[model samples]
Target: MSSPNELPPAIFLDPWLTAEGDGLKALSQTIAERVERQISSNLSQSARRDAISRRGLVVENLVANLAIMHLSPHLENRDLLAVATAKTKATRYDREDYPKRLLSGVVLAMEELGLLIRHPYAFRERSTTVAPTPDFAATIDRQRVKLSDIGRALGAETIWLNARTGEISFADRTPLKCRIEYQDTEETILLRDQMERINAYLNQSGFRFDGEHQGPVCLRRMFLLRSLSDPHSFNLSGRLFGGWWQELRSDRRHRITIGGERITDLDFQGAFCQLMYVHLTGKPFPGDPYAIEGLEDHRGGAKLAMLTLLSRRGDLKRLSPELKAALPRGWTAKRLMDAFTRHHPALRDAIGKDYGVELMATESRIMVELLLTLKARGIGAMPLHDGVQCAASSGGLVAEAMQEVTERVLSVALPVVEKPVVGQEWGYKEAA
Candidate 1:
């Protein structure tokens, strides 16, 4: 949306995609060489060579970094691929020292070459953003630069433990969450290898949105993401991310295609609570767990309440706007929390404690096992954490496979819910 005629939103960095691209690496090198040459008179030979040869500014790596940025807007809706450039700087993930030094130089060089227009990033909070200039957009069209030209970072460090937790800044200039870095262990490495295999299988699943045929498949690569709460533990809410379908609305996602075959949406019904219920009782939830007797109509509120009660740490202070809208008028989050506990006293001791990470960890294992099962049977699945997606024709089989995997992992078979395709009026709430 760097088009001069239309204003673009300020896109903050997303954790989903790294700013790395290998396409046009040679072309970028040529451009970087020219850029250094244009400034050659300003610095002597030794200084120029030293600057260019510095680790972060290595021409090829730096330009590929730019090329990914340049190519990103084309592959994804620019809004969907928000990567924090700050994290890229001085982090273990960016071991090469790329992006720390090369961003401005690449942007300026691209501007000079009329490849892009830049809105300077306010150093205070936002990362710099860019868009291809009209000429560059035209160039992209002419050369047909595309998704295959870009991908997950080359070395495939597909597992991450992020330390910077909160997003907002405090008035006194204190960061909301102190940043920390984590070291990897053998377990994390094993998860990374498993993810690489899954990614390899999924990347070939022929993913694309409806009505498009010419780009590389999406979510082909994924990473296991966890907060650095326990750097040594891979179990702290390790979720799989990096799928394009993840960015879609449910209705829109129904349009996804694998090898041009339309897909189906399936998930474990009420999975957050179901996982606990079944694991605790050794039985699937008896009925709609969110349907508290007095709050039968407040399923959403009940859901929000149960999630906060069981998953979040500490006290319930107030209702989020979404929760508030779902509850009875004048209900407090604390009131809802109390109501949830009163109805499900079995979970009383678990309230006010953090189980979100545990749930996700368990859910991650289930999803992985489900995907592997499907893979062994030559059926493809896209990991949706508590759910998965497969060709519509394969939905029943995927659902069955998922339940079997869940039963194996948790000793209870949580029901699989089939979400109908776009035209369907209603989806089945539980697998028959």
Candidate 2:
């Protein structure tokens, strides 16, 4: 293993280093070994060889261009593939499928050789334009690039790579740059600084530092602290409404007062809020309601909520016509719950009947409608389990419109706590 202090020498551009050259030779040998292994292990060797042959040709052509560029630090999308295919032909590997196989083999080798780094968060925006953010800068510095990161950054987690333009994208979002360049020493320093900055930022944000792992920072815990420290600001209908509600509930440390009733833990409250939101918006909740931490055994509540609003035969007889009209069409109480499970497969096993009773008893048509209207307007809706996710498009009118919707919904929900309690005193009280 290379020491932290040592840097790998630039062997690709070295001329004096013959076949015995350490870096280039090693890279070549590794590529060869990978191709050989792939060819040997393929279920049908003949078909594999044919495919590899064609792919190899393309790769050769591409490499030829790279040779011309002298393996320059960065290769744009078009140039990268072009050069690889050219190299294949120049090397007299004229198979039709050579380019495809060669490029795959090369990428695989580069990864194994540590020549290619994956970024954690690289993505394109909706404007068919790719703009590199501080996060991307940090990622390029880290010597790793994940294609998935590119998708997430653009808010389009599922994008297709364009074959014609060599463009990678999601939801009409295009990348600003196809690839980033990072040579040996540059990557290390960049990653170090980026991580340091991230840690510092987290600390400065008043977030209690917890241990770091391989995922998003423990913002949940930090948000919990923020909620506890400032109950008013963190109240369900206050500034910290919607998505933040789930985090408060999950940790079991946050509480809020609604009317004169002091809600001790936020679990049931969050679930209730989510159901109401779904009922209002006419959109399905993304996850199984039962999967929510404290609600696991109460799938029935979610089911009942779905039935009340979605089922035709549901007890909407008591609700105003305006409210009844908001229910899903052609749905029946019996099948409404099943539909929820079908639409969100991830929640299939988490809930059942007992939950239905709770939902029916506590159904709030007004609140549900309010949540749905906010959602239809593209405002962010925090369901019971999912964290805060942006529903609006990035930038411009769409984003602003959604923000407006969110503010309006918050205005109504937040005031519910301010009204004088009919039979009880208002304000926070200790749990009995």
* Candidate number of the best TM-score: 1
State each model's CA lDDT, in order.
0.61, 0.30
Give per-residue CA lDDT, model 2, range 66-92, as digits (tens). 232232222222111111212322221
lDDT of 2: 0.30
How well does each candidate superpose onto the true structure, as a TM-score? 0.76, 0.22
CA displacement after TM-score superposition, residue 189 of candidate 1 (Å): 2.5
Q: Which stretches of candidate 2 lie over 4 Å from their true place?
A: 1-103, 110-210, 213-296, 299-408, 414-432
Best by lDDT, which number? 1
